[model samples]
Target: MTPSPGRSYPILISVILVGLVALALGTQPIKPIMSNWPAALNIAAPDVLALPTAAPPAAISGAALITGVAQAQGEGETALEVYMAQSDVQEDVGEGQVRFTRRDVAGGALELLVLRLDEHTNIRVINADGATPGSDERGDTTWTDGQRHLRTVQEMTTAPYALRENSELLGAIAFGFHGEPRTANEGTVVIDGQVLRSNPGRATLCITHERRAEIGRFSSEDLARCAQAIGGGPVLLWDTLIANPDVATAEGEFLPFNPLGEDFVQLDWRKKIYNGRYPKTAAGIGLLESGESFLVLATSYDMTGIDLARQLRDMGCYAALGGDDDTSTQTVWRGQLTRARDVRPVPAAIGVYVRTQ
Candidate 1:
C-alpha cells in the first residue's frame, strides 16, 4: 500500500494495460482497434449485400391440336378426319353416309361439330314458311318452329339430312336492314330437284341440274337452269375480292387500303349499320386454292367486310360468298344441333344430305 515511487509506477502501468485490453474486447470498435494494430496488417471490408434471383416460370401443356384433311385410302374407300384439342382421329366413312362430331377448329379456339358428305350428296332447302307450329295456313316460321321442322324431316326420311344452317332470306316479320331481302322475297325455291317454295329471292344456294352448287348473286336466267336454289348474300369473293365501291368512293370498286395493308379499312356502311363497330357473325362458302370447297361460319371480333375478306383469302379461299348471320346463325350436324348464343327464328335453311345408293 505504501511502496516506493518507481515500483508503484511500474505496477500502475501494468494495471492500465490490462484495463485497455478488457475494453478492446468488450467494445470491439474499428477505429480504436485499427489505431492499436500494426500498419502492415491488411483486411478486406465485407462485400455489399445482394438479393437472390427468382426462379423461371413453368411451361404450359395440354394445348389444342388439329388435323389435316384425310385422303381416300383406296378404291371405294373414303376417309373422314376429326380434329380436336387432344388429337386427330380418322374414320372410314361410307358412301351415302355422314360422320359428325364436336371438334376444334384448325388454328382456332372455337369448337364446332362439322358434317361431311360424299361427292354425290343430295342437299335440300327447308322453307320456314312450310313448317309453322299449330297452323295449317302456312304461318311464319319461328325458331321453335324451325326446330320442329328439322325434327319432322328427320322422322319422315330414313336418309336424313346431315347438316342444316340458316339461309340468307329474312322472315316476313323479322325487320332489319341486313336481313331484308335484297330482291323480291317472292321467288321459287327448289330443293334437291323438288320445288319447296314458289317465292322469289328464296334462292340462296343454287344447284344446277348437274348438282353443282353455286352461291352468289344469281339472275332469273340463272335460276331457270337450276334444279334447286335458296336465298342468301352480298358475294364476298368471286375468283377475286369483290370490291364494295360504297366502302370508299375514291377507291372505286377497290377495297380501301389500310395503313397496315394486311387488313381492310372500315367501310361507311359498316359504321352506319353496326353502330361504329361490333363483332359480326357470318356464314360463307369458299373455293380453295387446292380446288377443294369449304364452308365457313365465322364470328368476327369487331371486323368489317374487308377484314372478313382478307381473313378468307388468308384461309386459301379464292372465292367466297357470305350468307345470313347474327342470331340467325346456326349449325346442325347429325343429331346434335347448335344454335347461336342469341337465337332468332330464320325463314329458311340450307340442308346437306347424302344420296342413297
Candidate 2:
C-alpha cells in the first residue's frame, strides 16, 4: 500500500528499538541478579557441609629428660668379662699382707710409700759399688796403727752411669764394700759397651744401654753391650718362682750357700767367706705387668729368699731382684729420711727417678 515516507520511517525505528530490549532480557538469567540480594530473598543458597583443612604435627620439647637405660644395658653385657680376664693374669692378693702407705716425698717426681712387711713378705737389693760413683764429696777417715797411719777419703755419691739418682737420691740401702781395694765383683760389669769388671757369677742384673733392667744368668758375650750391672747372690726369682731345691747346679750357676735358707749351719761360714749373712732389713726392686717399676723395703726383720719371692709374686711382680740390707738399709724417699738402727754410710746407691708427665 502507498504511504507517507516520514511516517513509515518513524514507525520502523520504534519497532527496531523494542526488539533490541526483548533480546537482552531473554539472554541473561534472573538468578544472577537475585544472587546479589540479601539472604532473606533465598534465590540460590550455598551447601550446608564445610570444606576439609590440614593441621600441624606435634613438636618435641627442648628440655626433655634422658633415661640412661640403654647405655647401662650395653655396659652390663660387655665390661664384666674383660675385667675378669685382666684379674686372672695380674696377681690379686685380696688385701696384701704388707700395707703400703703412700705419701708424697720431697725432691723427686716419684711418689713414696712406707712398706711394713709381715713374715710372708720379701724385698730386693741393689748395690752401688758396681756402678760409677756420684760427684758429691763426703768426708775422710784416718786410722792410726802404732807408728804407721792409713788415711781414707769417703765420698757421698750416686750411680754415675745411672744418672737418674744423682741429683735426686732414691737409694734405700748400702750394699757391698766401699774402701777395700779388691777386683770388682766376679762378674761381667759393662757400662756403655765398655767392660768395667769381668769375672764369673751365677746371676746378674743387666741394665741395657736403653735403660731396661733384666735379670738372669747371662753369658759374658750376651751382656757385653749392657750399660750397667749389679753382681751378687742366688737369683731369688727368675722367670718364675724358683724352688729352693732346683737351685743346685754342677756348673755352680747357683751359689750352694743360701743365707736365707732354714739351715743356719753355714751362717758364720757365709759371713766370713762371702761377707754376707741374714739381713735384719732388706730392699729390692720389681717389674709389674703394666711395665711400671716398684721398689720394696722390709725393715722390721730379715726376710728369707723364698718368702721374698712368694711375696713379690703375690704383689704382682713378674720379675724381681734383691738389693742390700741390714743396718745399711737407708732410704731417702722424696727427700724424707728413713734408716735402720745401724745407719752406715754407703759409697754409692741405686736411685730411681720418675719421668715427668
Among the numbered candidates, top lDDT falls to 1
Whole-model Cα lDDT per candidate? 0.35, 0.34
Once fitted onto the true fold, the runs of candidate 1 whose alpha carbons sit more than 4 angstroms away are 1-119, 129-188, 194-204, 242-283, 286-304
- What lDDT is reached at residue 79 by model 2? 30
TM-score of 2: 0.43
| Candidate 2 local lDDT, 192-295, one digit each (tens) | 46544432222345555544455543444555645655444443443333324333421222222331121122345433322323442323344433343333
- lDDT at residue 155 of model 1 (Cα atoms): 24
After TM-score superposition, what is the CA distance of residue 30 in candidate 2 from its true location, in Å? 99
lDDT per residue for candidate 1 within 198-270, as digits (tens), equals 2222214455675444543333334555676654333444333333424432232233221101111223443
